[model samples]
Target: MSSDLPALILGVLCGTGGTIGYVKTGSVPSLVAGLGVGALYTYSSQRIRNNLPYGIELALLASTVLAGSSVPRAIKTGKPLPQVLSVLAASGLIYYGVKFMQRE
Candidate 1:
């Protein structure tokens, strides 16, 4: 298998695992939201590294905050927004951080 395949599989597994875990614990909404946010973060990081004219880091932070804040809400009210936001933010951070580190 290719190296990228591992990363991709890991990502999917993480998301699936989180969802299953949350559902089992009756926190499905939160899991959904967090996953959404995480995906967003990942995408944003790529954009930033691509040299898009935007503050990728800030966007990532914002998404993170949004998602993180949503988790509690999901747990209490079964809402998924918080989780989604959190995931997106995390993805953004990861993307940019990786790109920045790779810069020559």
Candidate 2:
């Protein structure tokens, strides 16, 4: 599969998760972080699709942030959502990280 596919999926999941969090708990932070990172992932995915610059870098950054935040939450809360997000983010990190390295 293309590297962009994972980013796209992550973007959708993040957006959906964020929306759900806001609707269920009225958490503005969740909404903002989710939508913000989701947009980044989406834009990066588009960039990657178009063969533009920094696509992998942007995805890597977003994935790093997501992993950093979600991993701890997953560990602390042991919730399914956080755990899932953590896994996806970590996967994105590994995927984009490898792609980024390969480009050099």
Candidate 3:
């Protein structure tokens, strides 16, 4: 678990980067954020030797949604639709993903 800290930090950094990218480009930062979170989660899960019933892809999607929404908020865009939708979608994905994992 100790060794996974670097990966976790990397994930957070990537997540932040994605948020920045989205703020600047108004494009979805899904890929970047997903990569970061997936790497960290994978590394941590592996270090702990857990089954990690929730797959990396699902985790990445959830992370992307979680981190992606911050872009609009940070930019102070008055239009709340994109930000709200992104957050809701991300949250839903995560919620369902967790439920799926628990069932496994």
Top-TM-score candidate index? 2
Give me the displacement of residue 58 in model 1, in angstroms.
5.6
Please write out the lDDT profile of model 3 over residues 54-99, one tens digit for every residue: 3444444545545566556645775664465455445545654654
Ranking by lDDT: 2, 3, 1
- Go through the candidates in order and give each one's C-alpha lDDT: 0.51, 0.93, 0.51
- Can you list the residue pairs that collide in candidate 3? none
Instruction: Judge candidate 1 against the unseen true structure and give its global Cα lDDT, from 0 to 1.
Output: 0.51
Task: Identify the leading candidate in terms of lDDT.
Answer: 2
User: How do the residues 1-104 of candidate 2 rate in per-residue lDDT, one tens digit apiece?
Assistant: 99788889989989988999999999999999999999999999999999999999999989998998899999999999889999899899989989988999
Ranking by TM-score, best first?
2, 1, 3
**Candidate 1 residue-wise lDDT, 10-94, digit = tens:** 2354466558768778787647744654454444445544656443554445445554565567667875644653464455457
TM per candidate: 0.40, 0.94, 0.34
Q: RMSD (Cα, Å) of candidate 3?
A: 9.5
Mark the regions of model 3 whose C-alpha exceeds 4 Å error after superposition: 29-104
Q: For residue 21, what is the lDDT in candidate 3?
A: 59
CA shift at 100, candidate 2, in angstroms?
A: 1.1
Decoy 1 TM-score against native: 0.40
